[model samples]
Target chain A: MDFRINDEQRQMRETAQEFFEDREVLERARERIDGEDVVDDLWDDLSEMDYPALTVPLEHGGLGDDVLYLSLLLEEAGRVALPAPLPETLAFGAFVLDELGSDAQKEQFLPAIADGDQRLSFALYESGQESLPRDIQLAATPTDDGYRLDGTKTLVPFGEQVDTIVVAARTGSGTGMDGVSLFLVDAERVDSEPQDTLDRTRPAAKLHFDDFEIGENALLGTEGEAGPTLQKAMDRYTVATCAMTVGAASRAVEMSSDYGSQREQFDKPIGQFQAVKHRIADMWMATQAARSLTYYAAWALENDEPDAARAVSEAKLFCSEQLTQVFADDIHNHGGMGFTSEHDGHIYFKQAKAWETFLGTPTEHLDRIADSHEL
Target chain B: MDFEYTEDQERFRQELREWLRENLPDGWQAGERPGTDDPEENVEFLLDWQRTLNDGGWAGLHWPEEYGGADASLLEQVIYNQETARVDAPARINAVGIDFVGPTLMELGTDEQKERFLPKIISGEELWCQGYSEPDAGSDLASLSLSAERNGDEFLLNGQKVWTSYAHVADWCFLLTRTDDSGPKHHGITVFLVDMDQEGIQTEPIHQITDETDFNEVFFDDAVAREEHIVGEIDEGWEVAMTLSAFEHSMSDVFSIEQRWRSLVEFCQEHERDGTPLAEHTHVRRELARLHTRIQAGKLTHYRNVSKQMETGVPGPEGSMDKVFNNQTEKKLENFARRLLGANNALWTDGPDDGQWVTDLLMPYGKMIAGGTKDVQRNIIAERVLGLPKDD
Candidate 1:
């Protein structure tokens, strides 16, 4: 009944953790950078292992699992500090295709992702990173036999390499979240390339759609009805993202506790000190509370919970804000050695920096919650 | 992680609702309780009804067994209140005794005090008022100049407590006084339970905005309180006050509020001006819808509290959070009701049965101001919940 990973997902997580353990996970993460997006061999290894197929429907070359399965996969990604977009591209990419894409699009696109034949990334954020689908500004106007889209999309995750780009755009003049539609234009059709984002390991781009042409088949879901669909997709994505951040924070707290226990100051391990112990205790409680909310969010999304958006936003914002301090303090608690290149602390520290703003930052997520509650 | 209530708990919820319907007195159930300004309003009858509840084993749900309480489960307590208030049963007669003094006594009072005071509270034989503030010590409560000095086997108490709600009628007062002159302001205090009918106890009633003289300034001159009457360790009254204040802040009366909302809703739809039902307006509908949502959020906040208490066993910082949500929501509901009721609000703005829309709105200001201020709750969060650096 709790919002937690089930037995199968737990087992799957351990397996993935083992995979990263063998690959010298830290080494691979450190080797990667912004432009290069160091997910080279990892993506193949994942596809060969059929990890990408877990959340994809069986008809689309996957194990026919639910959002719960994707949560576990994201947790695995967090634990290993793997510099990859499997959690975003595979989990999110597959979900959009299943929910909003037509039968043809699912058949034509999902199997390639499931079979490791192609990589896909979603580009939902318009310029200024509008967190809510209703506020999207990218406009797609009707044309002869197709549509002509002219808009700029920022914060498009992994925009460079992915072959599929799921885009949300305005189809009508209705303001503030209505009259919107979702389309899956070919990534090659996008006129812009990936922009160098703050977190080099995870590339996001500003997509400039100048006279971008799409056939009638490219329209995803119903016209002027993409807001709800995009919301549905965002719920799954936000929950899964929160799942990753929770794992990363849990790891940070654990690593800090371990280091504090073993590293001594003045004649004993620093962990025994009241100041250090109390902080660790507080962090443990925060981690547990954040985990509870995040897992609940996953359950709500997977179970078609009616309040999914509210729960998802609450969870995402909580974890996003909590993880930043949990790890930042981990560095503080380590004193000096924690900052050295040899230390594993940087992995979480870097992940926190990237995640703090991912999927529209903590403040934006909080506004969604405030709005939902009519605050 | 699980938010589902157990089947037994759910069943108790239903039974409680039914029992509240059948057992409660008619006027008390409407809890549109008459104002004290009108003695004919029969508020005394509501007090008697409270005793009926105590007799029915429904009172003191949160108290320990030793205190004549059933020591009910937290969920059961919530359900009992939710049911009682849903039906608009009159509020308990002595809020100070039940919510404030009773809990503080259970926590820090001596065994003899528990035996002497507990049964009387349950039987409604004794009502309690707080004497925490003097004229000058209003918000800076610890600066209270009330003195309690050792005089043989008893202490001679002399203080003037202002804004003592219902002091004119209370049987006893939970009084805070300065017991020492040598130490820190917080260190030299003691809490005592003093009989209101003592030799030198006198009260002067003060009329408030609602034209009720239920509140007064109580003066104590050489009042004698036995050593056994002191609650908690001597010279450590601040600690007891802080703990009691925490409960005073976060503990929400969700069960009671549900009924208030219902009554407010009923009042709006039942009365009208011109030819239209007052509830027909779009603005009213939207406001009610928003109020319902806030109530839902408040309910969820309380549920989270239950889950937390289940996890932590004792309420911690979240107590402040509950306080913040309930007080804020109550104020909003009051304002919402006032706007919906319109000019009808002005008609009863002075009567005993005056439409509570305006009263409810004014009451919110008091709710947030009393127990603890809004800023204090935020400070608790910023310090205790957020782990921020305290202001030096």
Candidate 2:
């Protein structure tokens, strides 16, 4: 078995990493820490590079790379703390549409997304979820033409001002998971107010769907059967976010190592002190572990491994917990500058904390794993 | 990028699996290997098992073919390790001879040394221990005072080595001796192949916290090592010693870690707290999940190390990463299990499966110390891997 990435993946990683580095995505991220503002140039550059089409099938006017490829791009974005819903609009959104969308839906949407004319947002959370497959309180009552959606989806990332919104809602009757359906709605049909999220670098919103009407074509996949499809979509999202978190943590580790080598209080570099050196070493170790698990999870999901969902949850739990610690220790390594508002360290720190809570916390994923693996 | 083994490797894995199925001594299960309670019986059982492996041409698979090995490719060696660890086959009692002494001999030993020593190592007729660490040279190994003076056709060896695993049972030792005191400490050392049966050699078993005496303090009072037994040139022992230690650092039995973790998960599922399965508890679930994730990551890291080794033709600092991370994870897992067991943790030999958890819990401290201390590993990462400034 080989753990090394193939030449194609290596090229993809280099391209993505170089784009972020040359664009100074870190500075751009720093400029919009207080709010979510998509830098037009950065988005255009990504679009020009066909990043949004990363998950689309080659037959459908896009790059045909799998979840592993998308994960690399997201990780690069995460390393620079790029304040965008690339994972939402590109990785997760494109995946759901490609797998579950009809020909009409794909025809109507996929090209604009590929060309950067449209951005897709996902509305999956209703209120706050203590567990996954949470009771979908959002109701999608069938109408003569299509369906009318009512209820709110909290934590709808990039919820405001998106071209299309794919939402998870209960259609027919039963409680959990069953009768759950995914619908693509025009962004203008719903009301979205930006929420003061923990990481303003990537803003989230509370979406209010009050009699939001959608056409018959909006229904993604089979109505009640959308549960498994949605679960798969969420798994992809979890792995993508985990890959990003891994990137962010490694960046934190890199910055901390640099700081440790340069910063000194005594006769020697502070890195020479065991306490400082070991703590940074610990962060580095955790970051490597997170990266390995994330890559494995991506591989498993792409290859349809038997334990795919378990692997996804494992990556989510590991990367979330590890990135949080790495970011925290990174701040400690930076001393006073890390505590200040101006330093890029806090941006990574906040993004890490945000990502930890973003799909699910480590504790939540742990519970999910317990159920899945029957631990 | 592929995680699955090649077809040939898979076939080899199946072959080994079938061989193990037919040949493994009865009552052996993954994660249920016997300890050092009955050293002689354990030795006998292990030697017999090693002979079986040798008979099957599976012994020392990584060694060159001329030295009584299969001369398997790196992938085959990895698959062999993975499969053997999966079956919990009795660990080869001659592991020190095979993994450490034999490899060093292949690199630096005279042709006669290889012919004399390599066959017995694979045949399980001889066992070896490493004699690098002294009582005062635990982390600062170069400061070791174990001295040997050159004599005609021999070296008169004298001094002490501590924490030498299997020394009490080993038939020979790859020893580090300070041959000259005039120059730099690291410059004056030599490595010798010392016969354990010789006079003027004494071994005092050191009972570890596990209540086992696999480790010992070996004293050499004018012990004789023939000139032909010296590995590499004299005054270059430091480099020779580093070779074996590097192997030890990278070669963790990670599949066994996976097996133990699976058993722990089963334990968490079978036992309950507050009328719910212990795994159902959020805190317990979190701990178990953490353990599971690290084990998975450690397993993959081993693969990454192997991949890096294949590319570089030598193991890199990445092995130290595996060594540090795996040891730390084991320590955390053991501590977590101990707490989860609570009062039951004290039931050594009275608990489940004859107190295996108790032993497993106490066993990782040695791992942290062996190869090199965790601090030394961190130093290696800092200095060698990360290119950080070294201490004055």
Candidate 3:
């Protein structure tokens, strides 16, 4: 069996890279983080290319590319450290809508998503309960016709700017996984403020859904039946984030290797030393391994493998750990300048750290792997 | 890309699997080998097994059909390895000959050399060991100082070859020695197909940390190698050596690694500590999961290298990638097994699987050093693959 991507996937990857490169994505990312809430031109370009419809089925006015293609797109977004809501809008937003949204919901929202007429974000984690979404404290109380959403979701991607959000909230009595439900709510009804995250390239915000109300049609699936669907979406998100991590770590490795060749010490390039060479080698190997498993997880999700969750969790855990190590080694490869803000080292490292715990920590995923497989 | 094997490859896999099931020495999966308790008998038994493999046309899979090999495609080779590993079959006694000598000879051997040696090597009638590493040259293999002097139709060889695996049982050796000491150290070297039973050759077994004597130091004092036995041009053996080393990093034994992992998991399943099965411990479970995941990635990494090998017919720095990844994964797996087994890991024969864990734990450091030290792999990656400056 071959592990290399086919020609189409390679073309997709190259196109994504060329687009991002032409747009000066990373440079613009830095500006968007501190200066503006969004980059409209970049968003419009992505939508025009139908990037958001990648995972949606062909019947839904989308490309019907599998999770593998989506992974490649996210990977490109990561390589540039693009400060946008791509993952939120494409991976979490689009895939969840495709999988769990009824036909009417798909027709009403997917075209807007595909055309860049609307933006969507995900709100999963609550304050102090970052390890598991089972403890989602966002309450959705039953009303005459629909439900009222209250409580805060910390660390929501693009929480302040998106118009629509797919939110996870507690609907039943107990706080276990079964009581959780997902709903699409209007972002205007919530109070949002950007949080100061270590990764400034991709800004996150704290969203407070204070008594936000939505009709029954806003429920993603049957009432209180959104648990498994939410889980499926979260698993895809984990794998997608891992794809991004691989991209960032890979770029970090490339940058370090480039710098090592040009920089010199002891009358020779520092990279000539066995110490520096081996560390750089280790970084490359780690990124390769991380990338391999990330793609494997994407394949598993696309194939609907019975072990998809396990594979996704494994990928997330392994890639997170490897990416963190790669970032640290990359920094070390740069010497004193690595620690300074002048180099790109800190940017990738901070982004790596931010995504390390985006969905869950490596430890949390390890726990899931063990618990799910009953190992 | 699809991970599933094609139907034809799957059929080949089934045939190989059935053959292994029908022909493996009884109780092989229990870590039992023929004559495990007697060293001489073990050698003889392994030789017999190698010959048996030849009879079944399962030897030298990458060699040409004229040499009695199937000339299997890369995918078939991978499938064969995976199947052999699934059943934990005995390792071929002539692995050095099959994996290295035959392939290199195909690329560089004279027609006469191939006619005289390839059949015997593939048939397991003559076993070969590598005589590359020396007491002075380990990681820096090119600086090897083994000297060879031309004497009529014979070359007199003199030097010490250390860490020569299977030297004691080998009938032949592919050795490197200096034919001319006038130029750069790498130049003036020649590779010879030396008869191990020659009058001037002496092999003394060297016991490793696990107290096994698979490695040896072969002293050659005027040892005779026929002049016609040179595999490539004299003083240019470095290219031949590099080719052989590239084959070493192919990592066809990934399935063997998977087997070891399976054994470790079963061990944890059966053993208990603190009034619970070891597998029940959260820390143990976490480590197990991590090791499993890393091995999965390692296998894919191997496949990636194989895919490149298929297209290019030559290995690249990505070979070093596989080397580092496999080396680290093996070390981590063995270390985790050791820690999980605790005091029981110290047992030589009374412990689980006849005390394999102790030996397995101690054996992986050599993996890091063999074929090329981990340091050399990193250097190759940095310089050749990443285009970094050479070491000063």
| Interface root-mean-square deviation, each candidate | 9.4, 1.6, 1.2
- lDDT tens digits, residues A1-375, model 3? 887777899898999999889878888777765666555677877776778767767787777788888898888888888777777777778887887798899998887787777678888888754656677767899999999988888888777767798889888877767878888878887788878888887767788776788898888877777777777878888888888888888888889888888888777877777788778888888888888888888888889987788889888888778878898888898888889877777878888787777777788888787777577
Error of 2 at A217 (Å): 2.4
Give the TM-score ranking, best first.
Answer: 3, 2, 1
Predicted structure 2: clash tally: 0
TM-scores of chain A across the candidates, in order, are 0.92, 0.96, 0.96
Model 3 residue runs over 4 Å out of place are B245-253
Scored against the true structure, residue A228 in model 3 reaches a CA lDDT of 77
Docking class of 2: medium
lDDT by residue for model 1 over B1-392, one digit each (tens)? 35556898888887777767777776654544554347425557657877887887776767777777767777777666666556666668766787778888777887788778878887788888888878898656788878999999899988788888778878998889899868878898888899889778889998767555767888889988878898888998889887685552225755456556766667658766576665554455445544544454456556666655655566777665566666766877776776665655566745325545556667767767666665555555545654433333
In candidate 2, the residue pairs with backbone N, CA or C atoms under 3 Å apart (3 or more residues apart, or in different chains) clash, namely none
Q: How much is the lDDT of residue A270 in candidate 1? A: 73
lDDT comparison, 1 vs 2, better candidate: 2
The prediction achieving the highest TM-score against the true structure is 3
Query: What are the runs in model 2 whose C-alpha is more than 4 Å off?
Result: A34-36, B29-37, B245-250, B266-286, B339-342
DockQ of 3: 0.80
Every candidate's fraction of true contacts kept comes to 0.10, 0.70, 0.86
A1-375: candidate 1 lDDT, tens digit per residue: 122234666677888888877876656766765234466577788787787787888877788977766776777677666666676666667777787788898899888888887777777777565556657777799999878899888877777767777888889986666788878778876877667655555667778988888998988878878777677777777777777777777777777777766776787877656577556555654555566566666667877777777777667666666667777787788888778756766667776677667666765665555455443
